[model samples]
Target: MSKILDKLKVVELTTFVAAPTTGRMLADWGADVVKVEPLEGDFFRGYGKGLNVPADTGENPLFDMYNSGKKSLALNLKTEEGMAVLHDLLKDADVFITNNRTKALKKMGIDYDSLKQKHPRLIYATITGFGDKGPLADAPGFDTVAFWGSSGALVDLSIETGNSYPLNTPAAVGDVASGTNLFGAIMAALYARELNGKGDKVTVSLYGSAVWSMSFMNVIAQEKYGYKYPKKRYEVNPTAAPYRTKDNEWIMLTILDHDRYFPSLCEIIGRPELSRDPKFIDKIALLNMDNRKELMQILEDAFNKKDAHEWHLLLTQKDIVHDILKHFKDISTSEQAMANNYMSEFAFPNGQKAMLAKPSLQSDNLGEIENFRGPYLGEQSISVLDRLSYSKAKIEELLSKGIIKQ
Candidate 1:
């Protein structure tokens, strides 16, 4: 079957998670994405080494997850010949994606303004740590600092743990989210271009994405609002909290309508009488500090009497909105994930196999998206240059001069 983006050509000049993630998604949707790396390749190629995963075995799952289904063109952008090669590729390209800082992009003469003059129909998508006009625009930004730390997510989430030390965010969580947002913006630009025959420059920042992710809390967190952060578990609504089970596993409940579910929850926890008690009868009375504390204690004790799986079964039976917390290892083999094609196994060139996640979006037209390993450094350099109409002698000259790598 023809893929949704079969005819789209994307040139990706990026490293790390965010921009690469956008390129990966486009590739998954069937775009011919060419990843342009430096002669040393994307720095992320060595990321698996730091995690104790060997990179030499062609089994760098971390890199592959964000780079799969794309061709590689390792070039020396510092050289005029290499820059000429890149511009040639961009001449007929539909999109250009990058996460390089604006200063560096301008220095390399690939910034939006420079490219728009040449490739006016190209969709230029960029991801930054902060917005381009901010004081920190030129400053280095990573998911850890820009998304979680500066965006108030770190402090707000840490408050529930009852500690001054901030919690570390999971790896690339913000980058992936920001990348998804960039993908949406690129799709919108593509749609707009179809109507007006003009492309656009689209940008998404990690900090901005983080803030938008927390928009619900952000709006309520104003000084004029009664809501406040740093709330202890006991101080929160009992029906909407995490509880530890007898097996030491955690389960979270999300019963937004307390009045509707409080009685059922009380019955499930073997505290049916609490449903009748005026102090904890309704959501309003549960607002009382003492009443809330007592109910929390009762719920905690009740949850500890059953294993997480037992609670899961009970919650399913009662139709309560809840789920047992799962570790990363659990997700790989999750029945639901496997059933829904959220994860699948891929075999590396060396015959090593690993399960990897599919792109979040699913389409009936493009069922079961195929997974391919990421290209090696400059793996497609000759092929890409050949397709760009470079003569074999010129390609050899460029390679011999170290302007391109293979």
Candidate 2:
């Protein structure tokens, strides 16, 4: 059977991660995604440092990771001719996905209201920090500010605490979340349009998307606990926090199988007292303690007798739930990840053997796609213009006028 989005045509007009992410997902599923970039190209092209080689032209691993399986056409939207090219591209586009604001869009007549009039069946989707019409809408919707910090996630994760914690992973939380949710919205709208024979606008905000990802905590605080989480960091579960192993390595322990693992853990650690003491035994009572410091210290001391590897092995032998702190390299080389087909190796045009993490979904027939060395600035402009029925003469004229990047 054809892939899901075989008939879908996506005009991706936004830059950076979140917006491009939506288009990338669609393109992965076999949609005809045409990335409309600025003359300077997407800034993400410079996001990566030293390439596989010292002076490789395709140095942007970030760009390649996000924009694979899509064609790019560079155009200067500030130019009237470039804006004209956009409207032409929109003629039969099934969906328009963007993170750029309405004012910028209105100048190019790419606004939802404007496009909907021209092609009422076109699905218009947007991603922003706030709603398009809101006061904070104009704020740059970055993953750090909008997704993590503003969404109450940073505070919940306690990265906001003055007391030091490890730095966050270098991933775009908001962008990926926004992309995921926006993809869902676009697909749902497309499905709905089949029956209604009409398209609709789908909107997602960085702040709102971040909050939705935290629905579990929201429910627990509002309904179950009937109390607001403290503005300051509140330890949700004191016993489950990070602990140190005997060899001076950090291990996060959550003895939630307290009824089960508690006894085994005690036996392994030579701390039968903690297992036997009723005052410090049960979770609720332990939580209610006036002096948890003594108990915590005891547990920490007991844990420090062995290295992380020894503890991991000993705990697993007893069916305890625990894990080691895995770095990016660890996960990359992990046997489990390899077994699950999560990573694939490919040879780039430069003849470098690189490993790429697979997309969230998998298919037996889906093309194995690791060699897409992201486009040069407007690399496919002439080819893309040719598809739009522009003659070679016209394309050269446009390129020579500095109206589009090549």
Specify the poorest-scoring 10-residue window by lDDT in model 2.
229-238
User: Which predicted model would earn the best TM-score?
Assistant: 1
lDDT of 1 by residue, 1-406 (tens): 7899999999999999999999999999999999999999999998988889867646888889899899999999999999999999999799999999999999989999998988879999999999898688888889999988877777776656634767767789999999999999999999999999998999999999988998988888889987877687788888888999999999999888877888888888987999899998888898898888998999999999999999999888878999998899998989998888888888988888888887778889877876788889999999999999999999999999999999
Off by over 4 Å in 2: 50-56, 159-171, 218-239, 289-291, 363-371
Q: Could you give candidate 2's per-residue lDDT for residues 227-296 as a string of tens digits?
A: 4554322234435656678777767777786777777777877777777777567776666435355667
User: What does each candidate score in C-alpha RMSD?
Assistant: 1.3, 3.3
Which residue pairs come into collision in candidate 2? 246-304
Whose lDDT is greatest here?
1
Candidate 2 Cα deviation (angstroms), residue 404: 2.5
TM-score of each: 0.97, 0.87
